[model samples]
Target chain A: MRPDTPKVLFGIAGQLIMQIMPEVRTPIAGQTLTLSAALLSMVAQEFDRAASRLVEENRSVRTLLAASRDTVSEQALRSRIDAETADMHEHDFHVSALQAVNDRLRSLLIDVHAAVETTPGEAAAGLNERIWDELKESTRRRHLASGLA
Target chain B: MEPELAKYLTSKIPGSTGMAISNVFRIPGGASRETWMFDAAWEENGESRSEAFILRKDPPASLLASQRELEYAFYRAFEDSGVPVPRMRWIENGSEALGAPFFIMERILGCDSNTTRIQDAEYAPVRDAIARRMYEIMAEIHDFDWKGTAIEEVLAPPAPGECWKRELDHWEQVINENELSPQPIARAAIRWLRANPPPPPDRVTVVHADYRVGNFLYTVKGIHGVVDWEMAHLGDPLEDLAWSFMEAWEWTRDGRKGGIIWAEDAIRIYEEASGTKVNREALHWWDVFGSVKGQAIWLTGARSFQDGKTAELMMPFTSYWLINFQDEIMLRAMGRGA
Candidate 1:
């Protein structure tokens, strides 16, 4: 925390690419070092925003799930939607905990999306569009700069 | 490894004595296999013989669970068939010889296979010619007759209508087995692919599952060898065409396929060479399917590392760098992207 994580990580990545990679004798070793540095840079980028992304995504999927409760025709799926959206508070702020919640919600979102695609109505079609919007937003949340750049 | 390899060569090459291996080095970027290059010298029938060879050995766990024998058969099928490929020498199925199933082939020299190499200003003069030849060679690969070849022995040809289902089923199973977290986008893509399947090819042909630029060996002269046949199988030929057009292999972020040729030119060249009309709607279906397959590969690599089955840093790097990028590409392919 002293140097800040991104600064430290950028320094390490710089050293790996500029210093360590050239000294590696084998092509495989050099490639490994290069990829390690790239992974570190990506990890650093995620470190600062992982929790925020997960929380935001969990909230977005939860809202979508709640909106789809009426459109979902199956009893079992509706119960799942009710159970998952009942307590929407982020009680645990840990990245792992947030990610666990995000996974559960997104998995449910897939089922909801499949159901909505089949249940014929304007509401289902509208909700399906909203799901696609959320899915696109999800990619934006996890996007990283190209490593080759 | 050198002594063991020397022993194996001596045993295989009859009357070869004092077999020696040198300059052995592992090549980079082969995430699915341990590819090593080395030179060997031996005396056969009192004649001095030296050759450069490539060894493809199976890793304990890889991004792909391909059969090495099948890969060998695919490579063997293309030998001297107008499609340029390295000559296969020997294939060992048992792990007793090399700790894993492995195959050896004559290494093509003076060729560059790096993805970014052609983007340099130096290659500008021959880049178009090379790109044209790339598509021409792909047409040859698809037009190849695999009947009565080693390929037929190892691979079962899918029914014309079953091609799309077979590939989608295989990759979806891969994702189901290896995904570390939930993948909503990939799931949606799979559902869409199954609901709207691509029409079957005119006939079943060999689909070079990874036919992009990086997989081939090229020089200023022209394309020489098309390598990486680990995923070769019988499927719709358009699968390869759409795969060649995937954005994941677009190294320069250009709209060009493989950062070499425009999609239109590549499609024209492929169509002319194979005498098959290009179907835009069906190709779009495979383009979206390509992203799903790409995501499955990255996810498999991530799970391999997370489970401690491999320590290859490329595995995690691909997971971080390509998984989300692939989803974005899938979105664009499906016309749902911003």
Candidate 2:
């Protein structure tokens, strides 16, 4: 823990890739070992930012969904969005919990986006654009800083 | 496994006795099939005969669930054609043959299919030539006549105007069936795809659905063989072109299409060779569709890994690395990357 978890993971990944992978007898086994190393490197990256990214993205989507309520014409969708927005506060900081909350909110965001797009109004158009923007931002939030890709 | 393969080969080859398989090894990168390479030696008419062969056996589950017979037909149809493909020898549908249905082909030797090596300085001299021939061979594939060939026996040609809908519908269903979590971005992309469909091609041709930089065997001299026909289908030819241009295949990650040529250059070469016009609108539509299809593939592998159907590390590795990256690709293709 002194060198941090990510550093330790990368260290193990480096050993697997540079040392163990070469010693593997079969080609497929070697390739698997190499991929295992690369996976570790990427997993380390995800471990570093998984929680923060999920929490940030959940908040972002909930904000967009709440704002989309007025822009959507579907009453049912608006009510669902309101309920989802109200439930955005992630009581559990675990990555899995945050991701569950994120999934719920993002699924609602999709419905809100679909509703807003079909509704012909300036407000609907603006909300649609915001949804696209949030979607793009979400991709950035989940980006992993690893050379494996 | 080796003994069974050798036993099967003994019956397939004429005048062969004492058939034995050696150096049997798995070849990585075949996500859908359990691909293996081995050397088979037998006594043929009082002489020793040894040859290298590649076997592709279907796995229990995979990134793509295409019929092996269809893939075999495509390979067989293209034998001795302008498109360089390894000669397909035998296709057995009986799962009892090798625990699953499989086909055998002559192994292409002394060529590298590694996507990472093409950009290395060792291949710098022939990179452009490889890129040119890559598209040129693709043109040959598009131009091949499949009317009475084995290809027609397996895959029915889609209506020219229906290629877009057919492919989009297929991949959307794959995503719907396989996705563990809600794919909001992919779902939105699918909606947009339906809203704006591309025009059909003049003729439906053999679309090498997974044709890309890494999928082919190449050397500093040129490409030796185009492999991976599991996803091959009869569709709009531009679909292959656009799929090749998917950002995921751009190993350089610098917007170079396939990491060998720019989009304009690749199009120019392909157009001149295939005698087909590159419709920008249709190509753009296919590019976005390609991302959706790519995401579907990664999702399928993810599900396969999660379901304990496979212990292949490549499954989860692909899911972790490409799933979100594919989302970003779709966003960029849809003009929302900024």
Candidate 3:
């Protein structure tokens, strides 16, 4: 916390690439060092925003689930929608806690999205479009500027 | 490891004595295997001999569980053909000598396989020639007849109609087994693929599943050796073409496939060499399928690392760098990208 996690990570990554990598004798070892540096750089980026991103995504997906409650034809899926969106507030703010909740919410979102695709109605179509928008947004939230692709 | 390799080579090459292995070092970018390069020297009938060789050994766990023998057979199939490949030397499947199943081949020296190497200005002069030859070699691969050869014996030919289904099923199963979290985009792509299957190819041909720029050995002259045949199989030929056109391998992010040639020119070269008319719709379907398959691979690597099956940093590196990026590529391929 004193030096800031990102600052420390970036410093180490720079050393690994600029100093350590060139000294590595074996090609595979050099590659490992390079990848370790890259991973550290990416982890630094993720560390600064992990909690906020997960929380924002969780809230967004919950809203979609709540809106799709009626559009989903399956009773089981509807029940899941109601259960997941009941509180709509994250009580636990730990990154792991937030990530666990995000996983469940996204899993439920997939089922709801799949169901609405075949439901055959104007309501389903509108919700389907919204779900696609959220899916696109999910990528934007996870996109790393340093990503290789 | 060097001593073990020397002993193995002694046994494989009869009448050889004082076998020695030097320059033993692993190379980067073989995420699916541990690839090492070295020089082997020995005396046979009082004559000293030396050669550069490549050793591909199985890691504890990797992105895919490919069979070494199948890969070896595929390489053997292309021997003496127009498709340039390294000469196979020996294969040891028992793991008794190398600590893992491994195959040795003659190394194609003085050629680079780095994806970004071609993007440099120095390579600009021969970029077009290399790109044209790359697709031409791909055409030669598809035109090759595998009947009664090692490829046919090792791999079962999928019916033309079942090619898309077979591949989609395999990759979807890979996702089901390896995904750490929900993949709604990939799942949606899978559903669309199932609902609208591409019309079967005119005939099943060899599909180099990972045929991309990074997989080949190239130089200012041209591509010399096309490596990485672990995923080779009998399938629709368009699968290889579309996969070559995927955005993930666009190293420059400049829309040039493989950072060398445009899709239009690549397609035209492939058509001229193989004499098969391009089917735009079917190729589009395979392009989308390629992204899902790419996502499945990255997910497998992530799960492998998460499950403690591998300590290789590339696994996690690939997961972080490619998983979400592949999702965006898939969305664009399916006409849903913003």
Interface RMSD of each: 1.7, 1.7, 1.0
Q: Model 2, A1-149: lDDT tens per residue?
A: 28989899999999998788767899899888978888898889889889988878888887887787777777888788878877757899988888778777777877777777798978888888888888888777777775423
Model 1 lDDT per residue over B212-317, tens place: 9999999999999999999999999999999999998887787888999899999999999999998999999999999999999999999999999998888899
Tens digits of per-residue lDDT for model 3 on B142-235?
A: 9999998999888888899999999999999999999999899999999999999999999898888999999999989889999999999999
Which has the higher DockQ value, candidate number 1 or candidate number 2? 1
Which lDDT tens digits does candidate 3 get at residues A1-149?
Answer: 29999999999999998898878887778888888889999999899999999999999999999999988879999899999999999999999999999989999988898899999989999999999999999999999878765
In model 3, which residue pairs have backbone atoms overlapping below 3 Å? none
Per-residue lDDT of B249 in model 1: 88
Number of colliding residue pairs in model 2? 0
Instruction: List the candidate 1 regions with Cα displacement exceeding 4 Å.
Output: none
Which segments of candidate 2 are over 4 A away from where they belong? Answer: A1-4, A147-149
If both were scored by DockQ, which would come out higher, candidate 1 or candidate 3? 3
Question: How high is each candidate's TM-score?
Answer: 0.98, 0.96, 0.98
**Which lDDT tens digits does candidate 1 get at residues A1-149?**
29989788989999999998878898888888888888889999999889999989998899999999999999999999999999988999999999899889988998999999888989999999999999999999998875532
Q: Tell me the lDDT of model 2 at A40.
A: 91
* Residue-pair clash count for candidate 1: 0
